[model samples]
Target: MRIDPALRALRSNPDSQRIAQTALETCKSGWRSAEGNASIFAELIRYGRGDELGECPALSSLFADLDRAAALVEDLVSQILPQIAAHPLGQVPFRHQYSGGMAVLQLAAAGDAALSLVMYERSGDTPHSPTICFTDTERHEIALAGSGTMQIVRRNRGRRAPAELSVSSVEMKSGQNLSLCGMFETKRIESVEERLVILRLGRTGAAPEPSLEFRVADGELVHQASGDKRDSCHELMVSLLGRMGRCDAAPVLAEMTRSGSDHLRWQALRECLALDTATGFTALCGIARNPADTLSANAGSLRAQLIEAYPELAAFEKTLCLA
Candidate 1:
C-alpha cells in the first residue's frame, strides 16, 4: 500500500481533495464542452495549489487527457491544412474566402474512424457542457481544420452566453505567478476557495479561430456545408500554402495571378513570387502597363523590393522593373 506525496497533501488539506477529481471529470468530458468551463477552470487553478492537483500523481489521468487533446488539435492542423489549401476554390482569393464550416479529406472508403464537431446550445435535455471526441474510427488516418467559437459559460446550463477561457500554469509561469486569459472579467465574490476552481492557464499569442470547423476524414469533402465562409477559408489556405513553399501550390498561385478574381490579383501575384517568380514577374509586367494607378503602382513597388534582393530581376528594367 503506497500513496504519492502530492495526493496525500490534497487529501489532508482542509479545503477538499474531491475538487481535484471533479476537475478530472471535467477534462474527461472534454475541454471543448461548455459546462461552466470559465468558472470550473478558475476553480481548478485556485485549488490546484501545492500537490492537490498540481503534483498529485492521482490526477495523472486528467493531465493525460489534456495532453492527448492538444496532440489531436496539432495533428489535425498539420495533416489537413495542405488538403484544405488544395481545394479548387482555395487558390483564387487571398485575404478573403468562404468559411462555411466545411472540410476536405482523403477517405479510405467510407465509415473509417472520423472526427467531427457538434455545436448545440444549452437546450433542455442536451448536455449542459460542450463535448468533443472521436465519433468513428474505420479509416487509416484522421485530420481536420477550421475555426469555431467556443462559448464561455458562467452557469452549467447557462442560457446566456459569455463564457471565456482561462488557465494557470506553475510549470510555465512568466514572471512571478500563473498567467490567465479571459478571467476576472466579471464581478463575483472573491474567495480563496472560489479562485482555486480555475485551471492554471498560460499565455499564448494565438489568433482567433473561426466559428465552425469541419473534419477531413478521407481525401474528399465530407459533411454538407459550404458557402462564403468555407470558400474564404479555402482561399486563405491557398495563400498560406504558397507561403509554406509547397511546390504543389505553384500552379494555383500562377493561375490566380493570370485570370483569377480581379480584386485578389495582387494576392495571387504575391503568392506567385514565392512559388513561381517567372509567373509573378509576368503578372507584374502586365499590371505595370495597366491604366489603374493602384494596380500599376503596387506592381511597381513590389518589383522594386524584389529587384533589390534579386538583382537578376533588374534585367527586366526595360519592361516592368521600377527605377
Candidate 2:
C-alpha cells in the first residue's frame, strides 16, 4: 500500500513541532504569572483562609454578584481562549466529561468549592441523555451564551415516608442565572439550542445524606452513593480489619456501631460481628431493641436473618434473655 503524502508530511514536521513547543511554553508561563486573572481569582477565594476557603458563604457571595461574575468570566475567557489556540496540544488541568453530552473545566478551586466552565455542543446525531443524578452540594450557574430549558426536580420537604417530588421547567438564556440546593433539588438541561456555555460555582461539603439518582418515569430511586469521604474511609477500614481477622479491632468497630451515619453504623456493626461475634451480637441486640433508633427495624430484620442462616447464633439470643 502506498503511503498518503499528507500523512508522510505530518510524520516529518520537526520545524512545526519546535514552533508548537515554544508556543506551549509561552502559554504556560502566561497562565502561571503572578498577575494573571487566574491568580487573582485564586487569591480572592483564599483571602481570609489558607489555600482553601473554609466557609461556603464566601464563594456563594461571589457567585451571587452577577456583574462581578460576568466580568470574571469575560476576563477568564479572554485569557483562556488565546492560550488554547496557542497550544492546541495542551489540556486544561481539570476537565470532566458528563454522560449527558457536556464537559466541565474547573478553572479554580478553594477547599470544597470550585469555579468551573461548562460547555455543551449542539449535536443532532448524538442527542443528550435524559438520565439525571443529584449530588449533595450547592451550585450556582450563569449562562454566558446560547439558550436552553432547565428542568428542576425537587423532593417535597414535607413528606417523609414515601418520597414525593415536584418538577419545574425554566427557560435558560444568555446572562441568566440559577441556584440549586442539591440536598433537596436537582437540575438537568432539558433541551439546548445551538451551543451552550455556562459559568458554574459549586460547593460540595459533608452531608448527612447520600447523593441520589431517580428514575424519571416512575420517580423511584434508581441508585444512591455516599457523599461523605471520611465516612467512606472509615467503612473501608472496618471492612479491611474484618477481612484481616483483627479481633482486637472489635472494640473500635463496636463503638462506631453506636453512632454516626446510618450506613456507617450498620457497616461497622457488620464487621464487628464478623470479627467478634459476642460484641457484634450484643450491639445488634441493643440497636434492635431501641424503637427510637433509625436502624431499629433494619437491625431486627438482620438479627433474624443471621439466626436463620447460622443456628449457632441462636445461643446468643438465649444469653441475651439471661442477661
Candidate 3:
C-alpha cells in the first residue's frame, strides 16, 4: 500500500513530531488547570467519606453543577479537536475505547467522583442490547452535541404496586441534562440521531448494594456483582483457600458466613462446605432451619441435593433431625 506523502512526512519529520507531542501535552495541561475542576475534586474528597460510606451524598452536588462540568469538557475538547485535525496521530490522553462503538475520554477523577466525555457513534443495523445493567454509583449526564432516545426504568413501589417495572422513554436532546440513581434507576441509549457527545459526572464509590444486571423483557436478575473492592477480594481469597484445601481456614470462613451481604455469606458457606463437610453441613443445617435467614430456602434446597448425592450425608441429616 502506498502512503500519502503528507501523512508520511507527519510520521517521520522531527518538526511534525514535536508539534504533535506539544498538542497532546497542551490538552493535558489545560485540563489540569481548568477553572471548575479543582472545586469538583475538593467536593469529591469531602463527600466521598472513604469507600465505607454506603452512598455518596456528593452525587447531588455533582448533578447540580452539571453546567460547570460541561464548561470544562468544552474547554478540553476545544484543545483536543484542533490537534487531531492537524495530525492524525495526535489525540487526547486517557481515551478509553469501550464496547458498542463508544469511546470515553476521562477528563479528571479524584476520590469517588470522576468526570468523563463519552462519544457514541450511530450503530447502523445493530440490535438493541437485550440486557440493562446498573451499579451502585449515581450519575449526571449532559449532552454536548447530537441527540438520542433513551429508555429508563425504575422499580415500582407502594403497597399496591405491581411486580413489573415502571418504564419510560426520555428524549435526550443536545443541551439536556439527566440525573439517575443506579440503586433505583437505569437508562439505556435506544438510538442515536447521529454522533452523540455527552459529559458524564459520577460518583465512583460503591454503595451498600451490589451491582445488578437484568433482562429487559422479564426483569429477570441475570447477574450480581459486588461493588465493594474488599468484598470482591475476600471472595477471591475464599475461593483460593477452598481450592487449596485449607481446612485450617474453615473457622475464619465459618465466621464470615455469619456476616456481610447475603451473597457474601452464601459464598463463605459454599467454600467452607468444599473444605470441610462436617462443619459446613452443621452451618448449612443451621441456616436452613432459620426462617429469618435470607438464604434459608436456598440452603435447604442444597441440603436436599447433597443428601441425595451422598447416602452418607443421610446419616448426618438424621443426626440433625434427632438433635
Candidate 4:
C-alpha cells in the first residue's frame, strides 16, 4: 500500500513517528477483536434477563478494556495532530478513515482543501448500569484549515426530550479548531453513533471543485428539539416532551407545527397526534393541502409510513399535513 504523503513526512521525526505507528496498531487490534466478539456478547445478553449481563465477568472485563484502549489511542492522536498542522498539508486531497468500537477517524481532501475527523464513541464506565436511570452528556470539537462553514445538529428519537439542537457555528483560522458542548438525558441505551457533527469546507478554487459543502437532504433523521432543561425551546423537542406525557408541552407542539422546515413540522404533528389526535390531524391535513418541495416530500413519506404502521392513521394522511 502506498503510504500517505503526510504520513511519510511524519516519519521524519523518529520519535513522533514511533508513537503514531504504535497507537494506530494498538487501536486497530483492539477494534478488530471487539468486532469479532460482538456477536458473542449479544448472544450472552440474550441468555437470561435482568442480572445476566452484570453476572457475566467476561462482558464486564471486555467493556473495561475497550474503554481503556480507546482513551489511550485518543491521547496518541491528540499528540500527532498538532505536529501535522505545524507543517502545511500538500495540495493533494486525500481521505482516510479508521473505525473502531470506541473511535472513528475520517479524513478527506480536495486539492487545497481538506477535512479530518476524530469521532469518539462516548462510553460509560458501567455498561451494567441499565438497572438504574441516569443521564450522560456528549460534546464535539472540529478543526478546519483554510476556509469553511460547519453545522452541528443533535437529534433524539428516544423517550427523553430533544435538547434544542443549537445552530451555533464558529470561524476557523489555519491552525484553530472549534468546540461545542451540550447535555442530554440518557434514560435508555442509545446508539453510540447518535451524536453527529458535519464539517464543511469552502472550495479550494481548483477546477471542477469537489462538492466540499456538507448537506443533509434526508429529512427522516429529524431529531426532536433539544430539551437542555435550560436552553430555549427547539421545535423538535416539543414532540418528545409530549411523549413524556407533559401536557404543558402541548402548546410547544403547536408552535413547532408552524416551523419553516416541513420535516420538523411533520414530526411535530406526529407528536401532536399522540397528544391530541384531533388537533394534530387537523394541522397535518392543512400541511398536506399545501406541500413544498423537500419539506412536503418528507411529510408525504412520513405520512405513508405512519399510515402503514397504524392503519387507523391512514384516515389522517389525506386530511392531515398533505391534505
lDDT of each: 0.38, 0.73, 0.75, 0.42
Residues 157-272, candidate 3: write the lDDT tens digits.
Answer: 33232225567899887778888887678787778888888878777554456887767777777787888778888899999998999999988888898878787789999999
lDDT of 2 by residue, 1-323 (tens): 89887546656875665566666555544654535355445554663233333344444444555565566667655766786676555554355666456888776676666778898766565543444567877777888788888788888665363457677898877778888888788887767898788888776764546877766656577777678878889889888998999999998999998888888999999999989999999899899989999999999999999999989888978988799
Backbone clash tally (model 1)? 53
Reference-based TM-score, model 2: 0.71
Candidate that would win on TM-score: 3
Per-model TM-score, in order, reads 0.27, 0.71, 0.72, 0.27
The positional error of residue 93 in candidate 2, measured at the CA in angstroms, is: 3.3
Candidate that beats the other on lDDT, 1 or 3, i.e. the better one: 3
- Candidate 3 global TM-score: 0.72
- Per-residue lDDT for 55-86 in model 1, tens only? 43322222335443334344434544554443
- Candidate 2 Cα outliers beyond 4 Å, as residue runs: 1-67, 80-91, 95-100, 123-132, 236-251, 308-311, 317-323
For residue 226, give model 4's deviation from the true position in Å: 10
Q: What is the lDDT of residue 189 in candidate 4?
A: 21
Candidate 4 residue spans exceeding 4 A from truth = 1-236, 308-323
